[model samples]
Target: MQDTASQATRKVRAAGLRPTRQRVALAGLLFAKGDRHLSAEELHEEAVDAGVPVSLATVYNTLHQFTEAGMLRILAVEGSKTYFDTNTSDHHHYFIEGENTVVDIPSGPVTVHNLPEPPEGMEIANVDIVVRLRPKRR
Candidate 1:
């Protein structure tokens, strides 16, 4: 079986990003755990816990780079909190309001209709839907 480091290297390179040591390490952390969402602070804490020796600033830069390279999707929640989603496919999400958790909505369940037309000479990009969830009050 391929190790995590080499796999991260390949993944990063495949996404048109140069696999530096720190990038490879961060990529391993981001992709090794399967698809999930995390903020830069969370990832920085994980790096510290894993002894990766990376700064939060570097983590932010790396995540933005990865996002630009289409390796990740960015989700904005709670007005100021941003989470990076590892899954890049076309899908919606469920954001748990108080818990700060993000859950993937199955691909076929949610359907959107009646989108407004874009301005002249502009094309519509993919649509993103974030369904907020909270505990039902009894």
Candidate 2:
């Protein structure tokens, strides 16, 4: 328990973010489970259930702060629904449509080709490929 808190504090500080009570608590919940994807609302619910008094807005704010600090990546898999991925490495995902779940695709297996050149004065930052999936119908 104490180790998790300390680890979270160190992580936050390393990202150049202040390790506030809420930030540390949230970070603990986030990274403790290893690499995973979750939405702000889902995290907020976890916080509440864990007895952490926090608002949904704060969760969003902290998540954005982490994203800006490069600790997380924003994943938009579904319409109007955004997920934060703890694994910030370059990789792809498989989004299960009905289950609303995101699963990581192993690196190096998926290849992308034939990307058009960007407009003048603009370079591509990163490419995100989300392959939507559904159960085969009979």
Candidate 3:
């Protein structure tokens, strides 16, 4: 069986990113558990728990790098919360208001209708749909 470090190294290289020590360590943490969403601060905590010895700034930078390399997706919720998603396929999400968490909404159920064309020289990259959920009234 391939070691986690080696797998992370290959994944980093395949994404056109050098598998630096920090990047590899972070990647292992992010990918070890399979697809899920996480925030920079949350990942930083996990790194510390795993004894990775990385700063929060480094965590944020690595997450952005991975996102830019198409290895992750950034889901911006509300004005201040941001979540990194490992599943990059086309899909929507449900945001739990009180819990501050995101859950994937299967793509088959949501259908996007007409959207206004982008201005000249621009193109539509993708549309993000986030359905907010709150606790039911008593």
Candidate 4:
């Protein structure tokens, strides 16, 4: 199996990202944590701690670029923060409400389909589904 660092580089390159030092480094940090959903601020801090020379803005930009290129999935878990996902497969998410965190929910054989067809002209590019859940009130 390929190492996480190598896999991150591969993923960015495969998504048409140049895989520059910054991009690779950022990807490495994100992918190193298995199945993580992190905020830009959190990632920026991690990257900073990892000695990566990327500014918070650059981190945000790279994250947006990765999401746009389908290398990552971005989720809005309320407030003004965005969460980035290393897993870009067709899957759903369960947002841990009060904790303000997200987790991938495997659909098994079932997939999200059967949405009404797109309007005449615009193409159907992608579908993002977020399921929010909070701790049960005792």
Largest lDDT belongs to which candidate?
2
Minimal lDDT window, size 10, model 3: 1-10
For 2-24, candidate 2 gives per-residue lDDT tens digits of: 99999999999999999999999
Model-by-model lDDT, in order?
A: 0.94, 0.97, 0.94, 0.84
Stretches of candidate 2 exceeding 4 Å from the true structure: none
- Model 1 per-residue lDDT tens digits across residues 1-138: 249999999999999989999899999999999999999999999999999999999999999999999999999877899999999999999999889999999989888899899999998878889999999999
Error of 1 at 13 (Å): 0.8
Clashing pairs for model 4 are none
- Candidate 2: what lDDT? 0.97
Clashing pairs in 3: none
TM-score sort, best first:
2, 3, 1, 4
Q: Work out how many backbone clashes candidate 1 has.
A: 0
Question: Between candidates 2 and 4, which one is better according to lDDT?
Answer: 2
Runs of candidate 1 exceeding 4 Å displacement: none
Q: Regarding TM-score, does 1 or 4 come out ahead? A: 1
TM-score result, candidate 1: 0.96
Over 29-112, each residue of candidate 4 has an lDDT whose tens digit, in order, gives 888777789999999999899788899999999999999898788887676778998887777788887788788888774466
Stretches of model 4 off by over 4 angstroms after superposition = 1-7, 109-114
